[model samples]
Target: MNVTLLMAITINGFVAGQDDDTEWVKDIDALYKMTAEAGVAIMGKRTYDECVKYNAFPYKGALNIVMTHDKTLLTKSTDDVIFTDATPQGALQLLEQKGFDHALVIGGGNINGSFLKAGLINEIILDIHPMVMAKGIHLFEGDFPYQQLELMSFTKINDDLLQVKYRVKNNYENS
Candidate 1:
């Protein structure tokens, strides 16, 4: 399986505010398109909560996998959705067993941290918006060792939005 990390962060590398506010993320159409193309989305519980808070859960056209220790969420698992307590490697293994070819790790810091820390993400695409949140959620929130990224490419998504793609150096291989 090809695992990719897709997220939007401020120029200062914050993904959300203290209140879990994402009013700064404005490229929904682009985000939706890229995510849908992946066929599967893996996210943390908080990211799932935020999506539901805005009435946008069970992302259409893709299987949604949420990682959480909440056993109640297991009941929600179906052919199209999965709520698992799997670790980053475990989650990828599950997806591979299910025959998914590509998957996207849609974020909330800890999830990103786990995947990156496990060296499971082959690529990362960050939609860097032209804004700054002094104090909020950092891109990788959990404890992880240093990672090196090799620039793949970058493009101007809009007037002020820059989309940058990077490969996790030393770990980017055909998955």
Candidate 2:
């Protein structure tokens, strides 16, 4: 399956403010369009909560999977939205079983790191915003294994936004 880790972060690499404020990450129609085209999307609980708090829950036109240990979310599961405690791989497996060949790993931070650290991510497309925060949530929450990425493309989404795409190198490809 093809998995893409797609996110928007500050130039300094913060995805949200220290207090989890993501007001700066708003209204990027490009991001919404990309994830929607993927047919399926998975995100961590915190990310899901933020999306909800911002009135952006249940990404339209895609199967939205929320990964968390909070089983109560199961009650909210439906044909289009699934709340589960599945691992990143497990979530993607579910997507594959549903006949999806590709998915987008939407994120806040920790989820992005988990998928990358597990070597499950195939591509990363970052929407680089204009500001920098001294203290905040990073692009990747935990320590990463330092796999390299091949530069695929980089261009302006607008005057203040720049989008960069990279293909994650597999273990053998790095050799």
For each candidate, the alpha-carbon lDDT, in order, equals 0.89, 0.86
lDDT of 2: 0.86
Colliding residue pairs in candidate 1: none
- What TM-score do all the candidates reach, one by one? 0.95, 0.93
Give the candidate number with the greatest TM-score.
1
**lDDT at 42, model 2:** 89
For model 1, where is the 10-residue window of minimal lDDT?
166-175
Per-residue lDDT of 108 in model 1: 88
Give me the displacement of residue 142 in model 2, in angstroms.
Answer: 1.4
Count of backbone collisions in candidate 1: 0
Q: What is the C-alpha lDDT profile of model 1 across 31-110, one tens digit per residue?
A: 88887898899999999999999988888889999999998997778988899998888988998998887899999899
Q: What value does the lDDT take at residue 86 in candidate 2?
A: 79
